[model samples]
Every structure is written in C-alpha cells, then in structure tokens.
Target: MSAFSKALRTLSAMAIALAIGVAASFTPAHADPNATLDRIKSSGVLKVPVMVGEEPGYVKDPATGNWSGFYMDWANDIAGFLGVKVQPVETTWGNLAADFQANKIDIAFGLNPNPKRGLVVDYLSVPLFTDAWAIVTKKGYEKKTWAELNDPSVRIVVQKGGTMQVVAEAMTPKAQIIPVEDRPLGVMELQANRADVMILAIFDAVQVSKQIDGQIILPKPMLINPATIGVKREDGNEGYENWLTNWINYQRSLGLAQGKLHQTFEKAGIDLSMLPPEFSF
Candidate 1:
C-alpha cells in the first residue's frame, strides 16, 4: 500500500475509536434489575419507617417502647418473604421523602401519593387500601355537607403537610383552617372546642373520635384516596417493584390485606360498624 493511503487508514481508525469513546461517556448507566433485591438479601435487613400517634397504621407504646400496627404487620410479611429481618425507623409523615432520598428507609406503607413526592420516591401503582376523608366533630354540630363548612366561622383542623390539609384549603377556603403539626395536636384542638371540626381520613378520624368520644361524619362529596407503598427511587428496580406489586395483588385478591385492616381496627377498639355503610377499604 502507498504511504499516503496507509496514513489515511490509520487516521480513520483513530477517529472511529475517539467517537466511540465519546459516545460511551455520554451514555446513561442502568442499574441491575435485582439491584434492590440483591442488596436486601446481602444485608439481611429491610428497613421500614414507622410513624407514631396513628392507630391501625402505627402506634408506639409509651410503657414498652415497642411498636405495633398494620404497617408493622406489612413490614413483617415483606421481610419474611425476602428472608430478611425488619428494621423499624421512626419517622414523621413530612420526613418520608427526605428519608427515602437519604437512604434511611427502604419502604413506607400507607402513603397517599402526591405529585411533589412522586419526584423523589416511587409509589407502587397498587394501593394498600382506599381511604376517604371524614370530619370529626362535637356532638350536635350536625353539618353533613362540606359546603356548609365553607363559612368563615367554621374552624377546620388538619394535620399540616398532609393531604387533609390540602383538601381543607381547597374545599373550605373561607373557613378558618388550622393546620397542626401532628394528629394529637389536632385532636387536642377539637377537644378544647378551639376547632369546630378536624378533617382526617376515615381510619384516623374513627380512632380519634373513639379517643375523645366525638362523632364521625362523612361530609358530602366524599374525597376518596388510595394509600399505597412508597419506596426509594432507583434505576432498574422494576424487579423489586414488580414483585411487590404482585404480592399486593395476591394479598388483595385473597382479602388478606382487608382482613388485616379489620383486625387492626378491631385491635384499636374501633367497631367497623361505626364507619359509613357505603365505605369499603
């Protein structure tokens, strides 16, 4: 071959190699499908967050420092399925997304999926159960319609940073909206007669009403929402998510999840009949 032709061929080969390298540098990296599952197996622990001051979902005993609730049951089931131990991480509702981002918790149950939170974590498409908004009010308050509560004189209490607060703000804008830091405070406000009503999901309202001997009323135009599981967002974690989805589907199909909900409510000293007849989880 001529020297010029040989030189041209060598330069062409070098250009192709440089282009390949550049392309590879810009390519996005994908995680393995079993990445999360493998890690859980390797560590032998699945960390889950447990929230306090909520019955049926979570409750921390003051005397024993022990935790128990429906969520605990769920975590135990999941851990058992994976042959791992459950590590409970205490947290608040507002901190779940941050905790997931920080890799402090592996999964959280009964999270009401929202757009802002969706950016940080992945919510399983299948819901653990459905919940609806209800109002806990003093006896003889007698306002059944949300529109009736829209008056400025009505004081509506809701847990700050929760979907109940958003619903209160949107549906009863004219009412005096009181956002408390937690459920206990909101209940206190109701007990003190400082708030006319506290808006909470039916499960929470049921327990709170039982605590204070208040009445639980389903307001007109019920706001129904699904409570699903939330997990840390990671690439190629579909295998884990799919397994979870399938597990939930199987549990729901067999009424095991619903049975758990009933048992939890019963354990909390709440009668299922107290809920509105039309309501179904």
Candidate 2:
C-alpha cells in the first residue's frame, strides 16, 4: 500500500479507539457497599424502627395504624428527602436495642449513644430526641439526686432492657433494681408498694403518671441523656452511616425536631414544657 493509504488506515483505527474510550468513561460507576444513598434510590424505601405507645416523644395512632411522633416524623422526613416512603417497624423499648443489633431494623429511634452501644452500632450525628431519667415515686417521697436514690434499702423498678436500666445499674449500684417488661408495669409495681421507686425515662414516667391517677409523681432531679438513631455497625456500607447522620442534622436544621415534639406531646395530652430540653433535639 502507498504511505498515505497506510496513514489513513492508522487514523481510522485511532478514531475508533477514542470512541470506545469515551463510551467506557460515560458508563456508571461500580456499586458501592457503603452507598446507602444509592441503595435508597434503587430500593425506593427507607425502613426505620419506631416504638408504638403514648410516650410524649413517640406515639402511634391505633385507629389509622399510622405512626406520628417526634422521632417518627423525623424518620419520615429523611425518607421523604430520599424520595422514598418510610416503612416503620413496630418495636418495643425492651427489644429495640436487640433488634438494632440483629439488623432487624435500619435505625432505632430515640436511642442514646453510649460507648457500650458504640461497640455494636453507629449513632447518627444529630440526636433524634432525648429524655432524662426521672425518679417516680409516691407523692412526697422526696428523693433529690441520683445519689440520694442509691440507698441499699431503696428498691427501684426500671423497664427491662431499656436505657434507664443501664443508667440505674451504673448510678445506684447499691440500690435494688427491679426490671420489668414495660414502664407501665414498673409504675404498677411502684403503686402496689412492691417497689419503692421507679427509674424511668422522663417522658415515659410522665405518661405513666397520668394513667395511674396521681399515684406516681416525677420529681425535678434527674439525669439527662440525649437520644439518637442507632444503625447496625455491620451496615457501614455505601456511606449509609454518613447519609443517616446528615439526614438527622438536616431535620434539626429545619426545626422539625421541635415541631414534631410539640405535636407528639399534644396528641398524648401531655405538656411539652414538662419534657427535658434534650427531648426537643
């Protein structure tokens, strides 16, 4: 072949190679395991666990089977931003931590971030809500700080497997701790005189106090703790942990946290101001 013809053939081959390179470059990136954002986009839903009860910061309407609470609303907002629906997994306080550890739920709402829990789960950057520990006792029982409740003769009832149990065990090592399946049961134990005091989340204690018809009273002195969403450590894929953390911060910025708390308190017929400030998170 002539030199010009040979050059022309080489040019054509190079042009084809350039086209292939451009096409390859335009191809989508490989899937990332930590890509929680992408997974939400593909799956079109965000699964979250929510407790169903009359707790001031959390509630579920029995009539519609719809959940509405401070944490639930925040979770819904996160799902909305992802253009996905929120699938709420009903859970109880006693089993919420276990469910989160077992990967049964994507996030556990209204949880406190502790070093012990950090061993198993990742906590969001912004807390969903918070509640303080309240010492619930018969009217005029008159115990001040957690230290005051540390007497060996004092029997305190706490919700089994709940954060209060952890706090009680840590703070009042000498006191007798009674663990029950639910907070109301703990309240009942207090009412029955089986327990001297009930250590409970302030919101829960407030709700139980109303139900017991002034049988239980929540005093001012209590320990405060902020609660956040708990995600399984195993789910550290696709920046899912970061996405959730950002999502919670976004809600806090929007003032949705405070608004939802007010709404939840109103629905439960409890005064929002009675809640610890951290509960507004």
Number of the predicted model whose lDDT against the real structure is largest:
1
Q: What is the lDDT of residue 68 in candidate 1?
A: 82
- Using TM-score as the measure, which candidate wins? 1
Q: After superposition, how far is residue 102 of candidate 1 from its true place, in Å?
A: 2.0
lDDT of 2 by residue, 1-281 (tens): 99999999999999999999999999987766665567666777777776644365556677988776666677777777778888877767666657767756676677775766677777776675556767666666777667777889889888777777898898888999999886557767877989988876666666776665543333445456677777776633538777777766776788766667666677878775654443433
- C-alpha displacement of 139 in model 2, angstroms? 1.9
The TM-score values for the models, in the order shown, are: 0.93, 0.75
Deviation (Å) of 51 in candidate 2: 3.0
Taken over the whole model, the C-alpha lDDT of each candidate is 0.88, 0.70
Question: Residue 174 in model 1: shift from native, Å?
Answer: 1.2
Error of 1 at 133 (Å): 0.9
Task: Report the lDDT tens digits of candidate 1 across residue range 62-161.
Answer: 8998888989998999999999998989877777889999989988888886787789889999898898889999878889988999999999999888
